[model samples]
Every structure is written in structure tokens, then in C-alpha cells.
Target chain A: MDYFLELLIGGLTRGSIYALIALGYTMVYGIIELINFAHGEIYMIGAFTALIVAGVLAMSGMSGLSVLILASVVAVIYSAAYGFTVEKVAYKPLRHASRLSPLISAIGMSIFLQNYVLVAQTSDFLPFPNLLPDLPFLANYVGFIGSTEFIIIGTTAVIMVLLTLLIKFTRMGKAMRATAQDRNMAMLVGVNVNRVISNTFIIGSALAAIGGVLIASHVGRINFYIGFLAGIKAFTAAVLGGIGSIPGAVLGALVLGCTESFATGYVSSDYEDVFAFVLLIVILIIKPSGLLGHKPTQKV
Target chain B: MSTLNYTKYMEGMKQAVVVSLWFMFLTFPIMVIRVNTIENIIEWRWMNMLYIGAGSFILSFVWRKMSGRGISARKESIGAQGGRKFYLQRLVSEKRLSLPALGIVAVIALFFPFVSSIYQTNIMTTALMYVVLGLGLNIVVGQAGLLNLGYVAFYAAGAYTYALLYHHFGVGFWLALPLGALAATVLGVLLALPVLRLQGDYLAIVTLGFGEITRLVLENWNEFSYGPSGISGIPRPGLFGMEMDMHEATVYLYFLMILLCIITIFVVNRLQDSRIGRALLALREDEIACQAMGINKTMVKLTAFALGSTWAGLVGVIFAAKTTFVNPASFTFLESAMILSIVVLGGTGSIIGIIIGALLLILLPEYLRAFGDYRMLLFGIIMVIMMIFRPQGIVTGVRKTYEFHTEEK
Candidate 1:
């Protein structure tokens, strides 16, 4: 029972990170019907930004929650700027072309970013020691599950709450919803579509970066290619959650994380990939719109 | 004859001269450089000889036709002679005969053992393997309009299947090959089950995830797959009953590779004209229309996934046999991209076109061996330029029509 609980917690933590990234994919896809293939790379850039800011903070010798808070602010701002720039440069120009053009371009940007980082940082994995603790309270149950699980799940819950509040209650949130529903109507009604997209990129990227930091902190190591798979998982999470649906993304992330963790833990780990991919493909075939998404009927 | 007929004769003649000249040049260098063993120059050898022979045959035909010409301008001759026939003859321009030209090439390929060095043969073998990969992807991206971003997953699955079976179970390549294909097909079906509901961008993302997820699992799963160290020393393909290690028979092996290439070419060509291909194209153009017209889009999609993946799996088995190694790195996104590029550049849905595409794309970089680090930069620039100039591709609508006419015939 304790082991199961641990696995569940572990799953939730990973799911949280996935949920954050999934939100970006789902939102961009929801509005423009284009998969922002570069989204994962943006998450990558954010994680690196966090690394830099955290390094600066530690070097300056700031201590306690203040250090964490200050580092967090800088990381978020940096990642948001990075995300906005990525969209502006890669996506905005090809908006009028067929949907496939933007997708191809996004993939191109993704490849470019990965190679750029690999060239700049080298292809080796770097160790990132604990900027955040695993916390002792989780230790008593560590035998049952693990410390990483607690930190991830806890951070995720806090972030989710904040995100929910931001999306549901805020004026900007209302405007964002208005924009997603109908871009033309939103524009005519004086809601800035481009601004909303920029804002969406910022929020989504910040969440992914935070998730990235958590992942780095949990694992204590990362490489330039870190976001490649993680980004895909988060995208899966968004799809699982029914994309455009915020709660759905979180739900989807949790499911994917749990399913993968359990599969690794119990089933043949060698075929873990075979299982997850096959599962995703199966789900898409069965429910094309996704579990959380409503299918739109086509007009003749 | 009318003006058009006269022009045609003239154009045919010009092509004949040009083709024969090209063929002569191909052989002229050979005759001049016959000092060292024929294998000395690395690049010029039996392949060039075959090119010259084929070129000569085509050139002779053109020469014969042009000899009949009264007057000619290049453009007018092309119009008179028939553009397709001119291009076809012009393309070979060596032997000046179709069946005999082919026969000469075959005889040369057979005698390659007596001539060329081993390195050129190895490159030919590699190019043939890629021809299969290119054709498989064309089925998915070209026929079905489904963007399969993670095709390498199937390739890996196929390779690993061969390695595990042949190494551990003591299965022969023949048996292991089909089994690997089956496993990939099953996996393809399984993958299709989820993402079939998704279309366009959503489908692309899901497929991409599927690809990465497969690779990640393989990477992290240390025990069975040996983790990152990878599975090595897999078995090689064999002669009918003889072992490949018995002799330094590069030419015989090259012959076998050519046989496989021919079989692949034939199979893809047949599939391209079948009812299934038509259904796939219908789905590509308009999914709703296909559905309304009584096509079961689900089944068609699954068939695409299964067949396309099956080919990849088969190619994977061949790859495993050739390399004697299987690992996660070999089946990366770049492999998928290369295959996708081949399909796109070949003009999608074109069987022979993809062959040319694969041969050119893969061999182009090989020939530019001097460029080294700058190769990728140049390759990328070329791709961008190709897209800008000939986005419809080199072989676009030809195959579709070819399939129909063959059926009619």
C-alpha cells in the first residue's frame, strides 16, 4: 500500500510538470490549430534561464525563501520573454500559409534550438545539485514512495491552484477565454488577439520552465536534449486532458505520469515505450478529439 | 508529315546526339585512365561503365531518330518528338536501347565482382536500404496524408525484433524478417487505434509523442535492452545455405542487394496502383468526402499505418543484419526527417521518383565528402532551394496516372 501511494505521488509530481507544458500545446493548438512543435524547446530555454538565474542567486549568497522567490521571479520573466520571442520569430510570419507550413517551420525551429543548445552547451549531461530540498517530512514515507514525488506533487498543487485562479477569476483570463472562443469576434470586440497569444505563450512557458526546474532539482542532472521527450509527454498530457481544457491537461498529465511510472515499475521496462506510444496511438484512433475534447461536426 | 512531326524528328535527333555524347564521355575517361587496376579511381568503375552503356543505348536511339530529322531547334524537336519520350531517352542516353540497355546494365552489375573496388559496392548497398525506407514513408505521408513524425520507432522495433530473435532464438534471417515485420504491423495497428480520431496537427503531435515515448522507454529500460550500451553483434544475412563470412564476395552481396531493391521497387509499384492506394489518396484529399463516398477511413488509415510500418520493420531487419548492431540512437528523429525529406522531395506517391530521390539525396552528400562539416549546411540550403523552386516535387502526378494506365493496359 505504501509503495502504491509512493508511486501515485511520484506520478502526480511528474504529471504536474507535464500538465504545465501540456497547457501550452493545448492552448496554441486550440486557437490556431497548429501544434507548436517549438514549445518543448521553449521549455528547454526556460530551464536554462532558471539555471542561470539560480546560479546568480547562489553566487550572490542569498538564503532561504527570499532567494527562492527572487530566483523564481527572474526565471519566469526570462522564460516568458524567450517564449514570446520564439512565437514572434518562427510562427507569426507564416500565419497566413496553410497550417502545415507553420507546423513544418515550428519543427524546424525545434531542431535549430536543439542543435544550437547542443553546440553551445555540448552534448553531455550536467549535474544540478539541490537548489530545493526533498524535505524531511516526506522522509517518513520515503520508504513507501520517494522524496522527489512529494516535492513535485506539492509544487504542482500550488501551481495548479494559482493557474486556476488566474484563468477563472482574472479579467485577463476572461479576455483570454474570449480570444480562444473566436479570434475574429475577439478582435472585433477590441480584445487583442496577438496580445492574448503572447500572454498565453508567457504563462505556458513559465509553467514549463518551473516544471523543468523541478525536474532538474529532482533528478539533479540535465542535458541540452532534456525537453525533447518531456515536451512530448506534456503534449500527450494536453491531448489526454482534451487539449483546450485546462483541468483536462492536469488530469491528462497525472494519468500519463502514473501510467508510465507504473508501467516502468511493474511491466517490462524495455517495452515501456512500446506500451505508451501504442497507447497514445490507440487513444487517438479511438477518440480522435481526445478524452477531454468534444468532437466538432463538420459543416457540408 | 506536319510541322509538329518534323519538329519531333529534329528534337529526337538532338537528344540522340547529346545522350550519345554523354555516354561517350562516361567511357572516354575510363579508356584514358585504364592504366591502374580498374578499381583504382574509387568513383569511376563498373557503375560508370553501366551508365555509359545505358547512355549509349539511349543515345543511339536518339541518334537514329535525329539522323532522320530534316531540320531542328532544340525546343521544337522536343515538342515534335514527344516530351515524355524525349526525357525518357534523354535520361539514359548511353546504350540507346531500352531492354538491351537494361540487359547491359544487368550484365555489368553481374560482372562488377571482376571490376570495381569494395567501397563503391558498399555505398550502393546503403543506397538500396534507404530506397526501401523512402518508399515506406511515401505510403504514409504521400498516400494517406498522415504525418507520421516518429516513423523510426517502427524501424527500431523491426531491428530489435530481428536482433532479439536471431541472436537469442537461433532463428534464421528469413523467419526473423517476417516476424519482425509482423511485430511492427501489430504495433502500427495499436498506435493507430488512439490517434485515428485526431487529424492534422493533433495527429502529428500524437505521432511525434509516440515516437519519442518508444525511444525513451528503450533508453531507460536497462536490463532487457541492455539500457544505453545497446544490443550489439547481431547476426548478418546469409547466402541461400552458405554463410556470408565464407568469402570476400562484395560483388555477390551487391547483386543480392540489387535483387532486394528490385523486389522492393516492384512491390511498391504494384501497391501504388492497387485499390488501396486510390482509397488512401481519396482520404488524403478529403477525409469527409472519402467517408461519404463509402470508404471506411478508419480501416484505410490502419492499413496505411500497418503497411508503411511493415516496410520500415523489414528495412530495420535488413539494417540490423547489415550493421550487426541495434540501438536507440540509430532510430532518432533525424532518421525520420531524412525519410520524410526523401518522400517530399521525390514528389510523394512516386515510386521511381522516391528511388531517384533517395539515391540522389543519400549519394549527393557522399559525393560531397570533401565538404565534411559544411555538408549539413549545404544540404539544408539545397533543401530550402528545392522547396522554393519545385515544391510539387519531381515525380508528383506521374505515378497516379501511371497506376491508372497500367490497370487499363
Candidate 2:
């Protein structure tokens, strides 16, 4: 029972991070219908930015909590900037082109960003400073739930609620939904489609950045290549939940996280990634529309 | 008029400055600052900011000019009758020029091994392998419009099949070659069975997942795949049971690749004009319309997948023979990307374009050692720029058009 509880908490923590990244993918896909392949790169850049900020602040003798706050803020800003730039440079021009054009461009942008980081920063993995300080209240639950895991889950829950409100009640959110439903109709109805798309990228990127900071602090390591695998897994989570659906992305992420956690825990860790991919393949084969995604009718 | 021109120039310069400033800000943390967390030290490379500022300033100007020209050129092309033919396309279409060009190329290829060092011969062999791989992928992505991101999985399948066959049963290259391709074909069919219903991005991600699964399984399955330590010491291809030295073997492999490349080109060219070829093209353009026209979508997609994998499988065997080694590392997503870039850069459906793309991409990095690190960066940039400016590629594929004339009696 104790082991089960531990695995459950671990899965939730993992699921929260995946949810953060998956939101970006799902939202982008909802609006533009492109996979936004560079999104993982955005998450990676976010982590790197936080690492840099945290490292500098730590060296200057700032306290842990303050450093974490400042680092997270800067990471969010930088990631949002990058996400906006990537869409503008890569996707905006190819909007009128064939379906494959934007996808290829997105892939190109992903590669470019990865190489950009590799060239600019050292390719070796850097140690991410543990910015999450230990909470005295959580000391009794150390075995089953660490302070980092507690905070991660807490922060994620708060963010998810905030995101839900933003989407459900906000004007920009309404604009985003309108654009996603039909770009031309939204334009006719006086919604600035481009602005909505850009805002979606920004919001999604900000969420991913928060996820990046949390995961980096939790894992204690950072690398340029971290984004590729994480991105794929998050994408799987999104697909599992049914892409283009918000709550579905969260549910899918949690399910995927739990599955990975249990699979790796009971079985061997060697096939952890394989389990995720296999699950993805299985889900895709069984339910192409995803758990919550509606079946898209083909138009002539 | 001079005042107006000066004002325009000044406006452009102002925009360039803003663009450069934005770039400098964007690149500040990553490019200009390096923080050592363990050592608690900060290295601020202020010079990088200057470089980025200058680079972006110049690049923005170039970007504006190019885009301006692109819009006008597109308008002109649209206005022109019958559209403007690419020079390379014309060169290929005219037999008078193409035959001699082909003869010259053939002569150069035949004499290349003798004149060049063994190192150059090996490099050329690698380039030729890419040519075949590019052409093969062109069939699926170019003609059929199905993006198979896991194309390297089949390559890995072919390689591992040969490696395992040789490892377990002492199978020779001659036997393993056909067997490896056959194994890859079977895997392709199997993969296609599940993924045939998927289209576009969904298909891409599923294939990508499939690829990752294959690699992970290979990496973990120690007893079977040697668990990433890799299988080495595979023998090279043989000729009439004769033993050859290193240089002789290199030459042999080079010639073998050339022969295989020719055969692949021939088959792909013939396939492109065949009924199935037209079907693949139609599928790429419009899947629903094609099915509505009575074409079997499943069989066509399956054929494209199978045919494409066959070439990858063939090359995988050759790759194992050439390196005398087999490892999961050799068959990576990057390899698939490189091949896809070759197809995209060369012109998706254009054979001549792919050949040029392969040679330029593979050989340029080797020859230009100083820019080796930037090769992939350039490739990414090229892909984006090509898609934006000229999606048709360097050599556009010419479509066959028919004309009818009534008999005047």
C-alpha cells in the first residue's frame, strides 16, 4: 500500500509536468492545426533560461525561493518570446501554402532551435540548482511525497485552474475559441485571427516554461536534448487525451504519467519510453479521435 | 526622386535596426551569457551581442530584398504564359543536352575511384547511398505525400536483419542482402497495416513513435542486438570467392553503390510514370478525390510504403557491409531527417534535384571542414527558406501534359 501510494504521487508529479507541456501542444493544434514541432524546443529553452537565471542569482547569494520566483518569471518571458518568434518566422508565411509546408517548416524550426542552443551553449548536461526548498510541514511525508513533488502538484493545480478560467471567461479566450472553430468565420465576425494565434502560442509557451522550471529543479539536470523526448511524450499525452481538447490533454497526461510510472515501477525501467510510445500507437489504432476528441468530418 | 529614394533607404535601415535589436535581446541569455552552476561563476560574452546585432542587421536587409523580389517574381510568373521552366528542368528535358551530360557524368563516375584517394572513394560511396535513400523517400513523401518520419526504422530493420543473420548463421552478404530487404518489406507492410488509416500529422507522429520504440527495444534487448555495444567485424561484399585488400574492397563497394543507385533511379523513374505512379501523385494531391475516382487508397499507400522501404532496406545492408559494423546509433532520427532534407532540398519529386541535393549536402560538409558544425543549422534554415520561397525545390519536377489534334481531312 505504501509503495502504491508512492507510485501514485510520483505519477501525479510527472503527469503535472506533462500536462504543462501538453497544453501548449493541444492549444497550438487546436488553433492552427499544425503540431508546432518547435514547442519542445521552447520548453527546453525555458529550462535553460531558468537555469542561467538561477545560477547567476545563486552565485550572487540570493535566497532559494526568491531565486526560483525570479528565474521562473524570466523563463516564462523568454519562452513566450521564442514561441511567438518561431510562429512568426516559420508558420505565418506558410499559412496559405500546402499542408506539408508548415509542418516541414516547423520541423526545420525545431532543428534550428536545437542546434542554436547547442551552438550557443555547451552541449554537455548542466546541473540544475535545486530551487525548491524543503518544507517543514511536508517532512513527515518524505517517503511517499517529497516537498518538491508536493509543490509541483500544488503549483500545477493552481495553474490549471487559472488556465481554465482564462479559457472559459476571458475575451482573448473567446477569440481563441472562435478562431479555432473557423478562421474565416472568426475573421468575418471581427476577431483578429493572427493576434489570437500569437496569443495562443504565448500562453502555451508560458505554461511550458513553468513546466520546464519545475521539472528541471525536480530532476537536477538540464540538457538541450531533454526537450525532444519530453516533447514527444507530452505530444503523446495530448493525443491520448484527444488533441484540441483542453481537459482531455490534462486527463491524457495524467493517464500516461500513471501508466509510465506503474510500468516502469513494476517492470524494468529500460523500456519506459517504449511503453509510452507503444501506448500511443495502441491508443491511435484503437481510437484515432482520442479519448475526448470529436471525430472530424471530411469535407470535399 | 533622389529624396524619395533616400527616405525609403532610411526607413529600411530603421526597420533593420529594430530587427537587430530584437534579435540581440532574444539571444541575450543563451548566446551572451554562460553560467556555471557548480562553480558559481558567470561568463558574460558581451562580444556575442555585437556579432548577433551586426549579423541580424545584415540578414534583415537581405531578407527584405529577397522577399520583395519573391513577391514580384511570383506575380510575373503568374502573368507569364505557360509559366517559366527551371533551367535544370529544361536541361534534363532536352535530350540533345542531357545525353552528353549523362555521358560526361558516367565517365567521371567510372574514373572517380582511380583518380581519387580511397578516402574520397568512401565519401562518394556514402553520397551515392544518400542519393538512393533520398530517391526512395521521394517516392513516399514526394509522390505519395505521406510523411513517414520513421523511415529510418526500416533502415535499422534491414541492417539488424543482416547483422543478426551473419552473427547467428554465418550468412554471407550475398544472401543477407536480399533477405535483409525482404525483412524490411515485411516490417513495412506490418507497420502500414495499422497506420494506413492515418493521414498527415497523425501519421507522422505515429511513425515517429514506432521509430523510437524500435530503437529503444534494440537498445534494451541485449542478447539479441548486443545492447548498443553493437555488432562489428561483418565482412564486406565478395566477388567470385576472391579475397581482396582494403583499397580493392573500397573500390568494389563504390562500384556496387553506383550500380545500385542506377538501378534505383531506373526503377523509381519507371515507377513515377506508371499507373501506380500517377495514383501515388493523385493520392498526394487529394486522397478523398482519388478514392472517389475509384483508386484503391489502401493498396496504393501500402505499395508506396513497401516500395520506399525496399530501397532503405537495400541501403541498410550496404551500410552494414561498408562499415563492417551495425549499431542502433547509426540508424537515428537524424539520419531520417537528413534523407528527408535531401528530398525536400533537391525538389520533392525531382530525381535530378535529389541527386544534386544529396551530393551537395553530403559532400559539402566533408569538403568544408570549417563549416562542419554549422551543416545541420544550414540544413534547417534551408528547409524553412525553401518551403517559404520555393517549395518546388531547386529542380522542379515537370508534369506530363497531353495534347490532342483533330485529323484535317
Candidate 3:
């Protein structure tokens, strides 16, 4: 029972991080219908930015809470800037090209950003400073959940609620939904489709940055290549939950996280990654439209 | 008119400055700062910012001009005039020019081993292997429009088949070659079956997952795959039961690659005009339309995967023979990316383009050791730029056209 609770909490923390990253993918796919392969790189860049900022602030003897807040804020801003720039430089130019073109370009951009960071920074994993402080009230749950895990889950829930509100109520969110539904119709309705797309990238990237910072601090390690696996897993979550569906992305991520946790715990950790891929393949074969995604009707 | 031109120049300069400034800001955190967390030291490279600022300033101007020209050129090409034919295409079409060119290339290839050092011969052999791999992938991605990101998995299967065959049963290269190819073909068919109904992007992800799964399994299944320590001492192909030293073997492999490359080129060239080739092209353009026109989509897709894997398998066997070893690391996602880049950069569906692309990409990096780290970075940039400005690639594939005549005319 203790082991079960431990695994469950671990899964939730992992799921929360995946959810944060998956939301970006779902939102971007919602609007453009292109899998932004470089999104993983954006999340990675976010972590690296946060690490750099926190390191600098720590060296200058700043308070832990202030450093954490400042680093996260900077990371979010930088990641958003990167997301916006990547879409402009890579996707914008090939907006009308065949579907494969933008995808290939995205893969290229992903590779470029990975190597760019590798060239710019050390490839070796850097130790991420512990920024989350333990709350006095959470002492009883120490065996099952840590302070980091609690904060991650709490922050993710708060963010998700905020995101839902933004999408459900705000004018920009309405514009985003309109564009995702029918790009041409949205344009006709004067939704400023390009602006909506850019906004989607920004919001998604910002969310990913938050995930990156939280996970980096939790994991206590950061590296240039961390984003690729995280990105793939988050993408799997998005697909599993029915890509382009916000609520579905979160739900899918939790399921995937639990699945991975239990599989690794009981079966074998060697094939931990293989389970995700296998699950993805099985899901794709069984339900091509995903659990929540609608079957797209082919138009002649 | 002069005032208008001056204003335009000034506007361009202003945009360039803004673009450069944005880039400098974007790159500041990563490019300009290095933080040592353990040592608690901060190193600020302010010079990187200047370099980025200047680089983006110049690049922004070049980008604007090229995009302007690229859009107009693309429009013209899409128009009925067929636009200007690339010189490479013209060379391929005109028998007069192509014959002598082919003859010169053949003579140079035949004499290359004798004239150059064994090192050069080995590199050329590697490059030739990529040429064949590129051509094979072109069939699936270029001609069929199915993006198989896990193409390297088949390559690994082919290699592992040979290594394991020899390790267990003492099977030589001659027997293992066909057997390895068969193994890959079977795997390809198996993969193709489930993914046949998938959409394009989903297929790419599935294939990518498949590739990763294959690698992970190979890395983990210690009892089966030797657990990433890898299988070694795989023998090179022998001729008529004769024993040869390393130099002779290198020369032999080079010639063998050249022969295989020629055969691949012949098969691909023939396939392009063949009925199935036409079907693949049609499938690439529009699957629904092709199915409506009576082409069997499943069979065509399966054929593409099978044939494409056969070439990769064949090369995988050759790769094992050349290196005398097999490892999961060798068959990585990056290898698949490199092969895909060859197919895309060379001009999809263009045989000569693949050949040129393979040689340039493989050989240039070997020669330009100074830019070793930048190779992948450049490849990524090239892919993005090509998709944006010249998605048709360096050498565009010309479609087969027929002229119709009437009695009245």
C-alpha cells in the first residue's frame, strides 16, 4: 500500500510536468495542425535559461525564493520569444507548402536548436539548484510525496485552471478557438489569424517554460538533450488524450505517467521508454482519432 | 525614383537593425552566458552578442532578398511555362551532354581507388553507401510521400542479422547478404501493415517510435544483442575463396559499393517510369484520387516500404562488413536524419540529385574537419531554408509529360 501510494504520487508529479508541456503541443496543433518538433527544444531552452539565471543570482547571493521567481520569469519570457521566433522563421515561410514541408522544417529546426545549445553551452548535465522550500504543514505526507512534488502538482493545477479560463473567456482565447476550428472562416470573421497563431505559440511556450523550471528543480539536474525525450513523451500524451483537446491533453498525460510508473515499477525499467512507444502504437492502431479527438471527415 | 530607392534602402536598413537587435536579445541567455553551477562562477562572453548581432544583420538582408526572389520563382515554376530548367536537369535530359558526363564520371570512379590513398577510397565507399541509402529512402518519401522516420531500424536489422548469423552459425557475407535483406524486408512489411491507414504526420511519429523501440530493445536485450558492447570481428566479403589484406579489402569494398550504387541508380531510374513508380507518384500527389483511379493503395505502400528496406538492409550488411562490427549506437535516429537529409537536400525523387547530395554531404564533412561540430547545425539550417525557399531541392525532379497530336492539326 505504501509502495502503491508512492508510485501514484510519483506518477502525478511526472504527469503534471508532461501536462504542462503537452498543453503547448495541443494548442499549437489546434491552430496550425503542424507538430512543432522544436517545441521540445523550447522547453529545454527554458530550463537552461532558468538554470543560468538562478546560478548567476545565487553567485550574487540573492534569496532563494526571489531567485526562483526571477529565474522562472526570465525563462518564460525567453521561451516565449523563442517560440514566436521559431514559428516566424521556420513555419511562417512554409505556411502554404505541402504538409510535409513544414514538418520537415520543424524537424530541422529541432535539430538546429539542439546543436545550437550544445555548441553554446556544455553538453554535460548541470546540477539544478533546489529552489522549492519545504512547507511546515506538509510534514505528514513526507513518505508519499515531497515538497517538490506537492508544489509541481499544485502549480500545474493552478496553471491549468488559469489556462482553461483564458481559453474559455478571453477575447484572444476565442480568436484562437475560432482559428483552430476553421482558419479561413476565422479570417473571414476578422479574427487576425496570424496574431492568434503567434499568441498560441507564446502561451504554449510559456507553459512549457514553467514545466521546465519546475521539473528541473525537482529532478535536480539539467542538460541540453533533456527536452527530446520529454517532448516525445509529452507529444505521446497529447496524442493519447486526443491532440488539440486541452482537457484531453491533461487527462492523457496523467494516464501515460501512471502507466509508465507502474510499468517501470513492476515489469522492468530497461524498457521504460519502449512502453510509451508501444502504448502510442497500440493507441494509434486502435483509435486513430485518439480518445477524445473527433474523426476528421475527408473532404473531396 | 531615386528618392523612392533611397527610402527603400533606408527602410531595409531599419528592419535589419531591428531584426539584429531581436536576435541579440534572443541569443543573450544561451550564447552570451555560461554559468558553472558547481563552481559557482559566471562567465559572460559579450563578444558572442556582437557576432550574433552582425551575423543576423547581414543574414536578414540576404533572407529578405532571397525570399522575394524565391516566391516569384516558385510562382513562375508553377505556371504553364515550366520556368527555367536547372542546368543539372538539362544535363540529364540531353543525351549529347549526359553521355560524355556519364563517361567521365565512370572513368573517374574506376580510377579513383588507384589514384587516391586507401583512406580516400574508404571515405568514397561510405559516401557511395549513402548514395544507395538516399535513393532507397527517395522511393518511400519522395516518390510515395510516406515519411518513414524509422528507416534506420531496418538498416540495424540487416546489420544485426549478418553479425548474429556469423556469431552463431559461421555464416559468411555472401549468404548473410541476401538473408539480412530478407530480414529487413519482413520487418518493413510488418511495420507497413499496421501503419498503412495512418495519416502522414502520424506515420512519421509511429515510425520514429518504432525506430526508438528497436534501438532500446537492442540496447537492453543483453542475451540477444550483446547489450550495446556490440558484436565484433565480422568478416569482410571474400572473392572466390581468396584471402586478402586490409588494403585489398578496402579496394574491393570500394568497387563493390560502386557496383551496387550503379545497380541502385539503374533500378531507381527504371522504377520512376515503371507502372508501380507511376502509381507511387500518383499516391504521393493524392491517395484518394489514385485509389479512385484503380490503384491499390495498400499494395503500393507495402511495395514502397519493402523495396526501400531492401536497399537499407543491403547497405547495413555492407556497413557491418566494412566496419567489422555491429552496434545499436551506429543505427541511431541521427543516421536516419542524415539519410533523410540526403534524400531531401538532393531533391526528392531525383536520382542524380540524391547521388550528388550523398557525395557532398558525406564527403564534405570528412574533408572539412574544422567544421565537424557545425555539420548537424548546418544540416538543420539547410533543411529549414530549403523547405522555405526551395522545397523542390537543389535539383528538381521533372515530371514525365507526353504530347498529343490530332489528325486535323
The local distance difference test score of each candidate is: 0.72, 0.90, 0.91
Q: Is candidate 1 or candidate 3 better by lDDT?
A: 3
Please provide, for model 2 over B1-409, each residue's C-alpha lDDT reduced to its tens digit, 9 standing for 90 to 100: 9999999899999989999999999999999899976677799999999999999999999988988987887778689944676678777878998999999999999999999999999999999999999999899999999998899998988888889999999999999999989988898889999998887777888888888888888888998899888999999999999999999999999999999999999999999999999999999989899999999999999999999999989999999999999888887777877788788878888999999989987997787667856766776787799888876677877777789999999
Please compute DockQ, using alpha carbons, for every candidate against the native two-chain complex. 0.09, 0.70, 0.75
Best lDDT among the predictions, by candidate number: 3
The DockQ-derived docking category for candidate 1 is incorrect
Candidate 1 residue spans exceeding 4 A from truth: A1-4, A60-70, A133-155, A165-175, A184-192, A261-288, B1-124, B168-235, B239-270, B332-334, B345-347, B350-409
lDDT of 2 at A233: 90
TM-score quality measure for candidate 3: 0.97
Residues B1-409, candidate 1, lDDT per residue (tens digit)? Answer: 6999889777777766666565454233322222121222212245555655566758467435443341243346447754443344344343455567678757976776556667777777777778888888888888889999889889988988988887678887788889989989998998888667778757776777777777777787776576677888776776677645523545555666678778877887788778998899899989989999999999999999999999889888888877778888887876787787777776677775687778887888788778754455456545543443344555543533433344554
Model 1: residue A146 alpha-carbon error in angstroms:
9.1
**lDDT by residue for model 2 (A191-286), tens:** 999999999999999999999999999999989989988888999999999999999999999989988998989998989888998988898889
Residue-wise C-alpha lDDT for candidate 3, range A42-66, written one tens digit per residue: 9999999999999888889897689
Interface RMSD, prediction 1: 15.4
- Which residue pairs in candidate 2 have backbone atoms (N, alpha carbon, C) closer than 3 angstroms, thus clashing? none
